[model samples]
Target chain A: MPVSVKNSQVVYDALKELGVGLISALPETWLVHLIRMADDDPDMILVRLAKEEEGVGVSMGAHLAGVKSAMLMQNHGFLASINGIVSGAQLFRIPLLMLISHRGHMGEADPWQTEGGMLTEHVLEALRIPFDHLDHPDTARHKIGEAQTLAHASDRPTALLLCRDLMWEAA
Target chain B: MRRLEALEAIYPRLSDCVVVTIMGAVAAELQSLGHRPGFFYLQHAMGLASSMGLGIALSRPDVPVVVLDGDGSLLMNLGGLTTMARYRPPNLTHLVFDNESLLSVGGFPTATSTGSDLAGVAAAAGIPYSVRVHELPTLTAEFDAALDADELRSIVAKTEAHYEPPAATSGFVTDLGLLENRFQFQRHLASL
Candidate 1:
């Protein structure tokens, strides 16, 4: 089938290895399988968010309860969640690990996503939320682990941009 | 009923649950009674207290989670009600204090002042238990029952749009900084 299915499993396994007991996400195209995986897992608590910003508060709650959690969303979702990221996570010093699908990048076909994709990194930079790219399946696990570790160690928000290179095969 | 009096009425019952309050008047008023490890004044995040309580409740189903929200904050995140209803964790209790205005920030009129019904929205959002209380006694009784119920609950408490300035200063400020409160709250959760 498609490589995204395998890569999604890799990402899901990495999250499990990191002891992510809860994951909050808003549905997105690239994240369908990841959200499905979280939903199917009996041991995982998957929270479906109405807005991506709510994930920040969810992660803060998880942190307060000493439970590891992650937020799965698209680049646009990240853009929508800036207020919570700054006011909630940053202000409260919560470790927020966000897995963002990098849509509208170099080969983006959807015109609607291009502007958000172009601005995603700059916004993350402006917010000072450290981020890394997951462009290859081979390195997905390692990168995810490193990001999670850094997030908790620094007690701040960090992000992983899941690139099209790993998540899709261009038609 | 007055907001502070309402908070005072319910403060005694909060010892067993983790209480998350919105920033501004709610947090300040709660702090005035005293600080506890279980109390997290979600400072600056105006509208996400319900979301935070949902996370805590989902993470620790053994512990009860209460969200003290305001009409202005709740209106800003109406989607939060739908999300909370979607999960409907048994241990989560959402208490919205509808003062009809943003009392902490200059008593600005909110949607509630113009005929918005928070309890109606919450009930329509599918929370199993949703009610509106206009008096302190009803609020206290409903709050106690909500904690005891084995289903998700939401209560919209209508209080006067009155602001009480502290004798010395604005109760809007907390003694502990944001980071310190977070650490202390986390430690307390860990202890339990």
Candidate 2:
């Protein structure tokens, strides 16, 4: 059987262990609970930027504030945020734990998401970012660790790709 | 024109400015130009360039922040324009590279060619200045013109988007533990 906890719970557990100091993101259905989980603790600073790009900037500021920061957003927002991702995050070696909503792939019924979905992998590749598909909850912690590690080691941006089952319930 | 020309033109011409762009071909090209960039997320979020730049720019009103974005990426966060428009950062200048495709991912068409007017939308949202640049000469000219505008300026350039694929990593960052240390050293201050 698959891991019984919600995808958000898995994320909260992973982040709780990692001790993510600060986080900024748009409220995502998949990661909302996880974000809240990370928030209850005083050490974790959770801020919602007006836009995904602002989240990236804030996470960088959070870095200044002396905390490991992360930004969680959707695939579409990820696309919109690439410039900052490339220029701001990667250039400055600002490591941000990017937890992205896996839309436009696998049972994707939305027509608008198809194009954005197809571009997701290649775009990450172009950024020279290594991404792991969270197909199973068993892989979630390790994947999150890997991304956070990269940010820590190289000061480069790392991504965590969480799909439907990993993040959401069957609606 | 590629993302390089845009950055080369913008970064060199201006001083004390914050420049941001997306990941992929453009990011590499900008790097090749010998400029130190800020947080470069992998090529996942697009429209966020300006949003991030805005955060930095707002905090440091003394400096100028320019967001070099692509059409598709700009489309990713449609609401960003409204925020930018509403906030109206006088030091913010957004230059979008309109390639009309997700060129970095696959040579697929973006909504830009079909039905999006990002500049128009920025204007509608209350950006003090907005225009479209179909060629470099015009873009360069516009960039020169907007420098003195003293308000939020949205300049859209119609350019061919190109990309050479990047190597794959199972995860983006190398060590999760380092983030704590990295954040500590810089303290988020690029200078001073």
Candidate 3:
């Protein structure tokens, strides 16, 4: 299935407004369009990572060097990066902005993704990482900017969860 | 060769490079040697020293960055090798101290002990320069050459496992916490 370029543009514009200079991501079906947009942008450095934890590491490093960076991945990848996020980003007080695709939500079709969907908010709460759910495309830019502000002010990782409704045109 | 011996030889040659040391003996020993604002001592992020160094190198192109990684830690994130190769940051040099064991966690043998060739893997992953050294002189010479060149380099130094003594308390102050250390390093970079 082809990605919705218009839907991806909403999130991409929000990222640019947030001034994210670098982005590290592990590709997911829902994030294909956004990832492609990031790769083509000359102002942004797009890093394709082998694992989600590496994205955390890269974002932390970029933060240390005064470059604002974000990590884009699925909720499953978010679970994979918990250790790195806690030890590296949280311990060092490095501010990282994460854009996670919210899968397995209420009407999720894939059984494999449902478990991760249900556990996403709980895990974020457990880690004490604040998050904003972007369920509507119109509010994405404002929510992303707010998340960036929170991340920088707290010197911690903050997340913007993109729901399938906001990411897919048909949905 | 022991890890400290290799460190001792290379310590004198370090200039204005930002050094990121992996957790465990590597971090403890580097802390014991000296405290520099340029040194980022990773406490518990086992496999991120190289990744962090890569970020610094990419963002700060004028500054040279070095990563002091252990074989165990490197093996945990072998994928990092490919990531480094892909970007091939000219200002970054990764040195893995291959003691073939997780010395900090009671000396359990790692993959390197079973004939895993990290330098070869790095070469195959597309890093421009990669070498393995087992002697102090060769290690120092190779490191010096890498430092002098403007290219991504990797060195796997075969080292023997040795216990790192705890930081002395009589006259030494305790190291800064992670947040403070990060701020201090950032301050140093800003000043530069």
Candidate 4:
């Protein structure tokens, strides 16, 4: 199924407004549209990563280089990256803005994704990383900007969870 | 080749370059040689030095960024090689000292000891330049060439396993912590 063009536009606008210069993305079925949008943006450098943990490291490195960067992945990828998130980014106090597609949000029909969905907020809580849920495209720009501001000010990783309802165009 | 000797050969040549060292012997040895604000000694993050160096290189294209990684560390994050190659930052140089053992922990042999080729892996991953050096002079030449070239390069140097206790008061464990070191490094970069 093709991702909604409108949702991709909103996310891209938000990323641009946050001054994200580089985006490291791991494969996620739901995020294909956003990744494609990032690749098309002239001002942004989109890097395809082999693993989600690599994105955390790349984002940290980008932060040190004085470039604003983001990591795009799904809930499972976020789980795979916990070690890097804790040991590298958190320990170093490097700010990273993460865009995560919330796969298992309430009412999600995919049984395989429910475990990751249920544990997503818990994991972030354990890491003490604050996150916002994006339930509407209209709020994406403001939410993303706020998330980036918080991440930079706190010098810690922050996240925006993109719910399926928000990503899928209204029926 | 000894890791210290490999470091010594290239230490004097490093100027205004950001160096990220993998934790353990490499970090300790680099610290014993000389502590510079430009150097970031990563502790506890076993396989992240190369990735961090890649980040630094991508962000600061004008600054030369070098990663001193170990065989075990490189093996832990082989995916980092492909990621680094994909970006192909001209100012980045990745050097892995293959002692074939986890020297920091008890000397357990790594995959390299049984015959893993990191330079070959880097070349396969699409890095422009990759070489394996067994002699000090060749290692020195490789370092010099990597610094002089505006292309991504990787060097895997065979090193002897030697255990040297790290200083009790090294920069990594000081009260300053990683956060303080990051700020100091950033301030230094800003000055340059």
Q: Find the candidate with the highest DockQ and give its number.
A: 1
* Model 1: how far residue A6 lies from native, Å: 0.8
C-alpha DockQ of every model:
0.87, 0.14, 0.73, 0.73
On residues B107-187, what C-alpha lDDT tens digit does candidate 3 reach at each position?
A: 899988999999999999889999999999999999999999999999999999886575562222335667788898887
Chain B alone, TM-score, model 2 = 0.80
List the candidates' TM-scores in order. Answer: 0.97, 0.53, 0.96, 0.95
State the lDDT at A53 in candidate 3.
90
> Which wins on lDDT, candidate 1 or candidate 3?
1
Question: Candidate 4 versus the native: TM-score?
Answer: 0.95
iRMSD, all candidates: 0.7, 6.0, 1.0, 1.2
For candidate 3 chain B, the 10 contiguous residues with the lowest summed lDDT are B166-175
Q: What is the interface RMSD of candidate 2, in Å?
A: 6.0
> Which ranges in model 3 have alpha carbons more than 4 Å from their true place?
B166-174
- Which stretches of candidate 4 lie above 4 Å from their native place? B166-176
Judged by lDDT against the true structure, how good is candidate 2? 0.69
**CA-lDDT, candidates in order:** 0.90, 0.69, 0.86, 0.85
Query: Would you list the clashing residue pairs of candidate 3?
Result: none
Pull out the clashing pairs in model 4.
none
